[model samples]
Target: MNVCIEDCTPRSASVFSRSNLRLESTLQELSLYDFQVDLDQVGMVLAKMFETNPTIPGVILNHDSQFIGMISRRRFLEHLSRPYGRELFLPRSIRALYKLSQVELLILPGDTLIVDAARLAIMRSPEQIYEPIIVQISETDYRLLDTQQLLIFQSFIHQLATELLQEQTQSQLMQTEKLASLGQMVAGVAHEIRNPVGCIVGNTHCLTQYYEDIMQLINAYEQELITPRPSIEELKEDIDWEFLKNDGLQMLKSIQVSSEQLKHLVNSLRTFSHMENKQRRETDIHECLDSTLIILKNRLKVGIDVIKSYGNLPKFLGYSGLLSQVFMNLLANAIDALEETANHSHNTAKIWISTHVADSCPSQLRSLIIPPKNNPEYPQNTESSEDPLTPNSQYIVIRITDNGPGIPKEIQNRIFDNFFTTKSAEKGTGLGLAISHQIIYEKHGGCLHLLSTPGIGTEFEIVLPLI
Candidate 1:
């Protein structure tokens, strides 16, 4: 039976277009042969139909208008080639021929995933592997799906998967370059600003000492006076010298404190922006979190309440820069969510950042959020480690939670998808969470999980191996 490759119109029709082809596409979506013939029909009738339509893989057979089974052109032709086969089957009801030619039938539901159907189709016996599949559309309706068409769909899907992965890899590389450039720019700015801040801090310290020395001299002058100096007393009273001495010292101390804080902020920015490093090292997770928070303090100061719960964790051997990127993205998202919700309600906008070490995967973090490769039910990347919480395996768990109008359940699953976001254009590029996911999932062989309740809150959990 020649299944005409050209008649598989779905491919040319853009049914499998790069933008539309999905692993979840079903058998019914492809071209299905709906021609049916009665089991009692003469062989000549079915033979005539096959001759007229070579594209039809097979015909569904029914007994008295009731579907019974199916017979492919290949099998029909072979049965007719037997000794005196035409004279024997062509004259009699096709039921005799059907009974004799019956082979294993692969029946699948119409809604079966194409990938799954292909798997089942290939699992057929070698003899029946070329047979058309019986697609059960309903109780009494059936259609024929060519084995060749299915294999082609599977091949196309495989190609599309490879292309998608390549595109994602390229995008990630480009994003990495952007982050490195941004980091370099920030480092330069931080260096430039630290110089002046350093001067101010030093000058303020010296000025404080000078002021103390002048105050001590004034006191000595007062102690050394043999008689009341009326002119100096009148000058001190007119100028309010006592207030100046006390307030000037306090002002100098305040300048020193402000300058110190400026230095701390500069350091935080420097640490958070070190995205140019090419290697991983022992990184302090708490420091990374603190640096990210400080970088976002401007946004957080609006109305956000930050709650921190840091647990004992060991230094992790990982890309600190990339991890900080993830932290920044998550924290920024939390702050954004809280801010977006601030005007709509009276609730205190809050972001909760907590970290801890666990010997086992948390019950909630047994969760996986990675999109599927070919099967929509399972994620291939989530299994990077055989047992995420094997007996001796320890992991660092960091949770960034926010009290805001949480993400809708419908879009929660797709939040990590490339270029998927709920923010406006000016506020979002849709790449933040996706890049964060790649950093954690690919760079460190870790897991990123999302837990959200609509109208309640949202939490993003990052689980990294302690090693």
Candidate 2:
């Protein structure tokens, strides 16, 4: 007898990309078994079709061009192997055998997720667990999927998730090491500078006293000019003593002012160098922010103004060094955004920084701050919004807002993802905001959120509980 396998399109021909498949991949991406046969055909004909396509997992059954059900190869062969089964059923219609021994069929939509499909497939009775799945592609189209193939793809997705997690952890560790190294270097440099600045300040004071004594002697000489000799007058006029005497004091005063400025800068640098500290201290938030600004002084352009409204906050018990790092990242990003559109913005960039206790904030902004559950050991908040680690304790809110070209709405959702960046590789590692988010959310048991409107501006709001 001549028989042909109809509609035997292997799903493998329609490739599902391994690299592109993620945790949310659907069953539509998998290769399906689309071999179907008429239910009215005799069992011998169905057996011949299976023989023609030995690799097919199962056959979709239809009557009058309408989907009725399906029968897997394993089930069909088992039925045929029964005593006198071929003698009784082979010559009979496939519908006769199908009716006599039919098992429950598991059907899923084409859009069903791969992982979810696997779960549903495994829930079947042990006897029907390996049976082929009926996937309805549309009202008029249906197909079969091998349970083994579904589990394989789910395993691939599981492996991908694990690798991504490891990558993120390694990146965060490297970032923490880099910040510690930077803090140590800055502290050493600040220490070296303080000694020289102190010497200049101390010597300037001694020099001021000596200059006064010398001026006194010169005035005394002028007063005791009893002779008023012509040669003496000529010497004083040639030396221009009056101009020298006045300019000398002015020069000494200028030196003192410059030395004082140097000392202030050194102090700021030392404050920021706390990044290497492993212990949490009684940190002053305003001081930490001011030190960060001082470190970024060179980047803060003349046109870029930093307006700060610091609320009256008591000392916070936290890791100031890491918090300062987070502040630096957010501020630096704001500066870079402003600089990117400097020409278009016409040097009108401004950053507004505000800090306030969560309870003291206005009703609108207060809801955004969620207090941590525990006082001393608050756990990190995951990506889930419904189960935030909220407590009744007080919290602090820090907002860093910038008036610049805002982030595009499409890419904003992925801004905090690790190694994701729009800037060139040399300009950005894409880790600045990611590491900052980690420091605020995971390390400090807080939350970091970005609010932006295209062409308007962007703001990074950090909410930390006062633990």
List model 1 lDDT by residue over 278-320, tens digit each: 7788889998898888778788779788999999989899877
Whole-model lDDT values for every prediction: 0.81, 0.81
How do the residues 1-467 of candidate 2 rate in per-residue lDDT, one tens digit apiece?
32234446564523656877888889877778777778888899878777878878888888877889988889889889999999988898888888866889999999999889999999999999999999999996888898988888888888988898788679768876886788799889999999999999889988988998999998898789877889878887999978988999999988988887788788878877766346677889998999889878889955799999999888888888788878988999899899998888765799999998875324344344333322233333433453233556577889999998999999887787677788887888888877777677667767787788989899989888775
The TM-scores of all predictions, comma-separated, are: 0.75, 0.74
Candidate maximizing TM-score? 1
What's model 1's lDDT at 313? 89
lDDT of 2 at 84: 94
Q: In every candidate, how many clashes are there?
A: 0, 2
